[model samples]
Target: MDVIERAVSVLMHDGLVVYPTETVYGLGADAFSDEAIQKVYEAKKRPLSMPISIAVSDFEMLCAVAHVRPGMEAFIQAFLPGPVTVILPARNSVPEILTGGTGLIGIRIPSHDLALRLIERFDAPITATSANIHGLKDPQTPDECTVSRELLIDGGRLSGIPSTVVDLVERRIVRRGAEADKVEQFLSTL
Candidate 1:
């Protein structure tokens, strides 16, 4: 089977997969499946209180999981399908486990082709947390991943820098990484 098809199969079975993103290799699992999401946390040794980000194929998929505000469309149009994680109010459909009980979710639409295709084929958002222990350096390649996964889609080296996390509800950056200034500038206009 093709790589994305294989990744989708793994995620469908509540299994973890390591896939490359624009920023880093991501440990992905079905975002709507609590069992799948728990496995991601276990694999990465990530704390349960720390919410995981979800990657979508496009803005529409993002809207399915989070409550995208009307005015925020401009920001999404400018920054998404690139390296920026926008946090928005969560829809009731999003599990509390994914949000760490905060009722907020961080979402991304990575520029990487393989990552986008994987989400598209899977037909839903997937967990997009880095494929390493919570405190360790983010993995850029599959070999650098410390976590065990059912499948690995190696897309060569990644940018190593993570997406800048912007909290739309608070109108501030939660964490600065790649393109923080650019994201800030875009938000400033809105």
Candidate 2:
């Protein structure tokens, strides 16, 4: 089977897998599956309230999980499929656990072919966060991914940076990482 097929199978079975994107290796699972989503949090020892970003293959899928507030469409049209995470109001389609009891969700469409292909096939949001334990440096390569990760999808190498996080709900910059200026410009309109 191809990589996308394998990824869909593993995720469908509620298994967590490490995969590469433009930013870093991410531990991914079906975002809509509470059990699978919990595994991602537990595997990384991430706090339940910390929340995880959801990665999608297209804008339509993105809108399914998040409420596209005014001005969101244009921003997504420009910066998606790149290294940027846009936080938006979570729709009822998203689970409360994924939002940390908040009505917000961070979504992204990474600029990586394999990752995008997996998302397209899965046809559902996948929780995506840097493949690392809490309070550790983000991995820069497949080999550097968190030791606890059992499956690694080596996409050659990664940029060693993470997508810049912009909170659309709050209209502010949450964290400055890779592509800060680009993210800032998107957030500026809010």
Candidate 3:
């Protein structure tokens, strides 16, 4: 089977996978699977209180997991499928573990083709946390990943920066990364 198919299989079974994104490699798990989400935390040695973002295939998939507010569509059109993570109100279907009980969830529609294809085929959002121990450098390639996973979809040397995180609820840029200035400018127009 192809690498993506294997990764999808792992995700379907609530197992972890190490996959490349525009910015870095991510330790991915089914966002709705509590067992899989717990494994992601364990693998990364990440604190449970720190919520991880979820990666979606497209805007439709994003809407399925998040409550898309008015004016938010334009913001998403501006930065998503690129390197920006938007914090949105979570739908009832989202598990508390994925949101750190904050009632808000970060969503990413990555620019990388493999990442998008994987999520599309899986037909579900997957955890988008960096594939390394907490506080360590983000992994750009599969080899750099410190966390063990059932599958690794290596797309080779990802030289992009982390996605700028924008909180739509608060109407602020929570974390600046690749597209902070652009995202700020877009938000100003809203």
Instruction: Give the Cα RMSD of candidate 3.
Output: 0.9
Better of 1 and 2 by TM-score: 1
**Weakest 10 consecutive residues, lDDT, candidate 3?**
154-163
The sequence of per-residue lDDT tens digits that candidate 1 reaches over residues 98-187 is 999999999999999999999999999999999998899999877889998999998998889989999998788999999999988877
Each candidate: RMSD to true structure? 0.9, 1.4, 0.9
Q: Which stretches of candidate 1 lie over 4 Å from their true place?
A: none
Task: Give the Å shift of residue 42 in candidate 2.
Answer: 1.1
Q: What is the TM-score of each candidate against the true structure?
A: 0.97, 0.94, 0.97
- Candidate 2 stretches with Cα past 4 Å from truth are 147-150
- Superposition TM-score, candidate 2 onto the true structure: 0.94
- Give the Cα-based TM-score of candidate 1 against the true structure: 0.97
lDDT of 3 by residue, 22-137 (tens): 89898899999999999999999989999899999999999999999998888898888999999999999999998999999999999999999999999999999999999999
* Candidate 2 vs 3: which has more TM-score: 3
Give one digit per residue, the lDDT tens place, for model 2 in 1-190: 8767888889898888788899888888989999998888888898998888899998889988889977778887888888889889999989888889888889999889988988889888888888888778888787777746435688987888888888876777888888798778756765
